[model samples]
Target: MIASYDALSEARKALDTPLFAGLPGDVAVSFEFFPPKSDAMMLQLWDVVQALAPLAPEFVSVTYGAGGTTRDRTHGTVARIISEARLPAAAHLTCVDATKAEVNAVAEAYWEAGVRHIVALRGDMGEPGAPFVPHPEGYQNAADLVAGLKAIAPFDISVAAYPEMHPDSASPEADIDNLKRKLDAGASRAISQFFFEPETFFRFRDRLAAAGIDAPVLPGILPVSNFAQTRKFAAACGAAIPAWMEGLFAGLDTHPAARQLVAATVAAEFCRRLYAGGVRNFHFYTLNRAELSYAICHLLGVRPKAAAAIQEKAA
Candidate 1:
């Protein structure tokens, strides 16, 4: 499970977290979920929602699949979270393969449903390895999408940021300029793409500050449930997987249970370092699983109301 016997011991030591002085409520968090295409996945998603509901994240977001492929399903999921669960939910809106009229209509529907937030994006084409092209009649990019959403309503908008620079960007500075444009157009905050090193995010954050853009850019944390899958995701998103990570996950392909502990330990340490660096808000890529995320949050000093009862019993 661990790289070596002493490696396990050292990892546990490295994870001696600085217990949060702030209450869980003081540390704001939000979770991102993708809409389920199958009946079984739908049931499983609700289970995850129920499990994390007690954590009281700032808001939960359901991702819109490429080219608005999951349009109806995304709406259904967001509506249920708002109505059935009585949680504030944000729906992802993408400007790909849809006219501006259609996209604005969807935004109106969300407003009608009492959803007040939107994560605007220039989503990819539905096909694998396909390039993204703007619909002739649709918003041109995320910045344009943010402005369009603002025109419809003053929705609290969140847009994506690339800590390592977007794959399409000509340069990192250009990428930051694009991010500033989105925020200036009306996005309230930017959720960064996931990165392994805290330094990567810190550097990006510094660049944003130096650019004179004043907005919160929350760090996105992905608790790696599967290393192989995560590596591929990272590669696609242009995130670097440092050599150290492979050594940690090495030989654990057949050890799912052990992988959970290692994942928790790595993510908890990641959070601890971020928190120590003065980053307060985090957005987790939950991947429709609760156990790993819940564990990492608990280790970062987040506790549900029910955890208090358990603590009382222990006392």
Candidate 2:
């Protein structure tokens, strides 16, 4: 009877109070983007950076393509973000087909370009579903890659985490152990792969605590504006999509604007739940577009830096 009463009271409070009101914007956010391939795409990405710049993200990251295919483009993009946008930028580095000397050269170049952060990974093979074969002379895994980066320079490193168990892992425990190895090696934090339900992250957080790992793990938030495409990718990465989400997006193919609204609402609620569960940092997979991420950040009480400052002053 007590549990029932408490549930009812909580439901009533949710109904009476606006969901996003009084949030105080005490959260740190980071965004991830892929390197642009062409001149036109470069311009589009610049606009995206401009749009989200006012929010003053903790840092922005550019992804390294599979097999280190986009090395040059990634460097160019990260350098531009640092020199032009004046934002702290992190370059993604991988141990795939690159020898130790080659990888170190890239890291040295980034250090010369004023980049002080890196997202290190044991990237996938060039072809999907193919087993990852480390180069004959390259670092064996992400842990080794992290150590190598530290040996070269003091890069603030962030490694990937798989809340849903990475597709390549033998089991959940093994996955957590691998994450521990990375953190133990030299990574400062882990940025989790995107998952739909808030409980997914909550459960992973519990597991991490139980495993005696306490480093900050930023929840990766992917707002699903393109449900079908997201579903396909999620399947590849071992992320589960809730059935209710399919029902929510079920006939919105022709309704782009409405789909975006639904996407923002879902992602914002997910972030809000994480916040209630003691999550104070969020990492967004921006997919090179700013609208959905921008909207969700706004709902979470994150505003332009200047506006947020003024509001705090008034209060």
Expressed as tens digits, the lDDT of each residue in 114-208 for candidate 2 is 99999999999867688988999999999999999999999999999999999999999999999999999999999999999989998999999
- Clashing residue pairs in all predictions, respectively, total 0, 0
**Which residue runs of candidate 2 sit more than 4 Å off their true CA positions?**
1-16, 307-315
Candidates in order, TM-scores: namely 0.89, 0.93
Write candidate 1's Cα lDDT for 144-240 as tens digits: 9999999999899999999999887899999999999999999999999999999898798889889998799889999999999999888778899
- Taken over the whole model, the C-alpha lDDT of each candidate is 0.86, 0.90
**Superposed Cα RMSD, model 1:** 7.1
Best by lDDT: 2
- Candidate 2 TM-score versus the reference: 0.93
The TM-score of candidate 1 is 0.89
- Backbone clashes in model 1, listed as residue pairs: none
- Report residue 121 deviation for candidate 2 (angstroms): 0.7
- lDDT at 152, model 1: 97
